[model samples]
Target: MNTPDTHSPVLEVQSRRRPLAWLVAIALVVLAIDLGSKMWALAELADREPVRLLGGALYLSFARNTGAAFSLGSGYTLVLTLISVTVVGVIIRFASKLRSLPWGVSLGLILGGATGNLVDRFFRDPGFLRGAVIDFFSLFDPYGQVWPIFNVADMALVTGVALAVLLELTGRRIDGTRAVKERKTAGPGTRDKAEQA
Candidate 1:
């Protein structure tokens, strides 16, 4: 008569749950910051000249973007909105497989950023699913002549994507495992011991 191995199962469950918790917490924080910044920009920067900062390296100017990131795909607000919705759905579907802290963080940033812009598409001015996104941060030029005006959501999306790409290139799996490369044996007759066994 031996005691049961209760600790293993409990630890496994906690490991699975921890990643999801991090994902949700990070996503909520990103969403809140994006929304808050947008609100502040709308209230304080409206109808005002661009506020220069960092010796003109950055400018805070209000802008309503009717397009995707970097002001691309203008005149296609509805299509862009649909695309964002699809992205959010995909992230949610993938969340169930999250078992790595880094993957969780990457997905969380993407989900939060996508949701932030989606909110604007649904609730901002000019009607539902066709509303413009509030943008305030500008680089180099105030009128967005040098660079497109952007917001916090765009920043998060870009950062998340870059991190995800880096993780993939580094062979970091979503299950917290490092991918291993298989080595080939020299010569045709050289069979590996494992294969022979």
Candidate 2:
């Protein structure tokens, strides 16, 4: 009697899970960095002047954003919080289907960034779900004159979304499969040439 090959199935399962593990690891690292930076900003930059760097090209200026990234949609904190929560949920649900390394990395960054800001929205000043996000990095000016003040989470989120878009444009999919391109129909001249050949 032949024995069942249980090891093959187990190995296949592990292989499928490897990408998910990578995603989780990347996300945790991003979340930790963003949260830590925000904590440091709140402690060291409070009531202090902006810290200039790169000959004033960059400034670390503490600011509280009650809206989405770059301070957009201000005064709608609750709405933004709910939207973020929904995004996080969708990402988590889709994680189980992740099998491509690039897709995993992109989604991981987005998940981490979203979760980082969500933490602030849930626990920061003012109240739960209405709290503001801590932003400290400013470009060109300390008062966001040239660019909106942002945080690490915003950076990660933007990078992730950009990467995802590039992957999609290049025919990469989340399940490690390249999208099949449709073949062009042969023109009359081409068909005649083929027939002659």
Candidate 3:
């Protein structure tokens, strides 16, 4: 009787290729939504002043931020521009190394957010490549303790980071912990268990 091969190359090919495509698709979708919302905000609120969207709980106001999140380093447009470029480059370079869906989604969110903000910096008013990003979403105290105004892009980035953290913690505990245990129990000659470890 002929012995069946233990490994399937086709399964490996499908596994790797499918997930990578999914990641790229997710990234594109996020970027589309983020940019679309910003465009809508620009058209609706550009000339108008800030307005309360939820009875002072959530406010929609228009302001152009020339800095990173929360308006930090407000005048350092060149610095922010460089940072954005670097982020995009890194995302592209390391996208293939992400081993899980959660990681891919997180990276996609970050990429979309960074792209959205970078678009504003390049295209908004006051100068080319030094334009402020439009930030209108705000959560504030009733008496007007100002929270940092942010845009849709910022929202994506925040959520993505949160997801990435959760995934890393969970993955380490689940798959990684089990693999480590298997290695210790099997000692050295069990090649399959060692590989999994």
Pick the lDDT winner: 2
Each candidate structure's TM-score, on Cα atoms with residue i matched to residue i, is 0.88, 0.88, 0.77
lDDT of 2 by residue, 97-192 (tens): 787888889998999999999999999889999999999999999999999999999998999999999988877888777775545577533221
Task: Show where candidate 3 strays beyond 4 Å.
Answer: 1-7, 141-144, 171-197
In the range 93-190, model 3's lDDT, one tens digit per residue, is 87655545556677788888888888888887877778888887878642225778887788877887788678655543211121222344545664
Show the colliding residue pairs in model 3.
none
List model 1 lDDT by residue over 1-197, tens digit each: 99856459886687679888988988899999999999999889997999999999999989999998778888999999999999999988888877788888998888889899999999988999999999999998998998999999998888888889988887777766666555665764533222100
**Model 1 stretches astray by more than 4 angstroms:** 1-7, 186-197
What are the clashing pairs of model 1?
Answer: none
By lDDT, highest first, what's the ranking?
Answer: 2, 1, 3
lDDT of each: 0.86, 0.89, 0.71
Error of 1 at 78 (Å): 1.1
Better of 1 and 3 by TM-score: 1
Q: Residue 189 of model 2: what lDDT?
A: 31
Pitting candidate 1 against candidate 2, the one with the higher TM-score is 1
| Steric clashes per prediction | 0, 0, 0
